[model samples]
Target: MQAVEPGGVSPYRFLLVAARLGSVRRRSQDVDMIKAQRVEAADSALIDPAGSEWRSAPSTRLSLEPTPLISQPSAYVQAKWETIDYGAIGNVSVQALHNDGGIFFRLQWNDATENDDIRDTDQFTDAAAVLFPVKEDAPLTSMGSPDEPVNAWYWRPDMETPFSVTSEGTSTTIRTIDPNLRGNGAHTGGAWAVVIGRALQSAGDGYVQLTAGEEGKVAFAVWQGGNDERAGLKAVTLEWQPLELEA
Candidate 1:
């Protein structure tokens, strides 16, 4: 299959490609919006992916596809991945909950291999991220434009904590260690469950401030270390999904 160049196709062309390749397991129309359940302030399990509190929140399964090869940072990456099949992870289960303190997202996916060790040059840890647009009209495929940015709460099994990432278009990502961002992950059986949490409001610039009783947009990305997936070589939601928070 020929890889579609970024500028040659629409932002949502990945869906068509996946459909033609028979890789898309489900359509986005099945789950139109992600409703964040309202929880009490004292619920300590909000940040815990394995906690029982997640049982009360609803889950939305999203079908994912490989990011466009042309969107990669360099020619080396494009050439290296031209004939290779990467981003095989096809689906991810997502749940959201919020309280007066913060908003939490739980992402669950299946993986036969648990890659937590990153000691060698070829080794990389499994990772996931939840992205929100800084502006209402920000583009999802290119990770937003110069005037419009996107904020990402990134988590990996090897790190002690998650990272606050901001991006303006492809290859323009900036990662920061934010004390406010917290994450917990656990691998049980053949699947990985991860929870990333942050305050509803922003602590500083480059942070996407989420408000209650309003609607926003969110996207997801996953990197399978065993598949040598990193940077733009990961599975992602092609379009932004609507997110509605309870009042």
Candidate 2:
């Protein structure tokens, strides 16, 4: 498989500004937690974002904001993007489910342009990711410190499957292929629906292991390819949203 550099803005670098701003904090108690409903064994059909099974799952709408231009890792990167507006995809709808096999997330967002292919340097493929902290106190805004790593399930339309990304602080992202990581995406009617999933338990080292009846934290990021949003220059959730998995 061809290895693609984490693009749009360097993916993990987007959080550097948050670290500098000292916004890192433990998960909050008052934030509304999104529950991952339990379901029977999921089939391939359930992996489709538009599948009927999703109708039965609870949904949450997450508002997104542009990663600050001040967060770009380098002056050149900052300069190149200073004149343009990115992160135009302001919000996304999320639904989640877990079975005996794994946990899955369905994300849908409005995008007038379907940018699935990149044929030139100026082109980019739309992308999205779901992030979870490996440790309870890990900061979602900084993508975790070396002592508190973060796990990410990342998807881009051009890839045959999603990528498993782990990071120990900003600019420390590592990407690897995980056989169990699955993704399906479809674009229609001025919108895109995508599903990304993984086994309920950790696939291996560097992966977050999850359990039922437990509470955790999650975050999200989206790159609007049509707007040249990539890497650290995308829309993101600044805070870690609470997540609960039903027993």
Best by TM-score: 1
> What lDDT score is found at residue 241 in candidate 1?
85
Off by over 4 Å in 1: 1-31, 41-43
Candidate 2, residue 186: the lDDT equals: 95
Query: If candidate 1 were superposed on the true structure by all CA atoms, what would the RMSD be?
Result: 5.3
Tens digits of lDDT, candidate 2, 1-247: 1011234333234355445757564443313477998888565866888788898888888767677677677799889977777777777888889885788989999988899989898999999999999987887666788999999999999999899999988778899898889999999999999999888886667898889888898988888998777888788776788899999
Task: Quote the positional error of residue 212 for candidate 1 in Å.
Answer: 1.4
Please list the Cα RMSD from the true structure of every candidate, rounded to 1 decimal place.
5.3, 6.6
Candidate 1: tens digits of C-alpha lDDT, residues 88-145: 6777999999995688999999988999879899888889999999998888788988
Task: Supply the global lDDT for candidate 2.
Answer: 0.81
**lDDT of every predicted structure (CA atoms):** 0.83, 0.81
> What TM-score does prediction 1 earn?
0.88
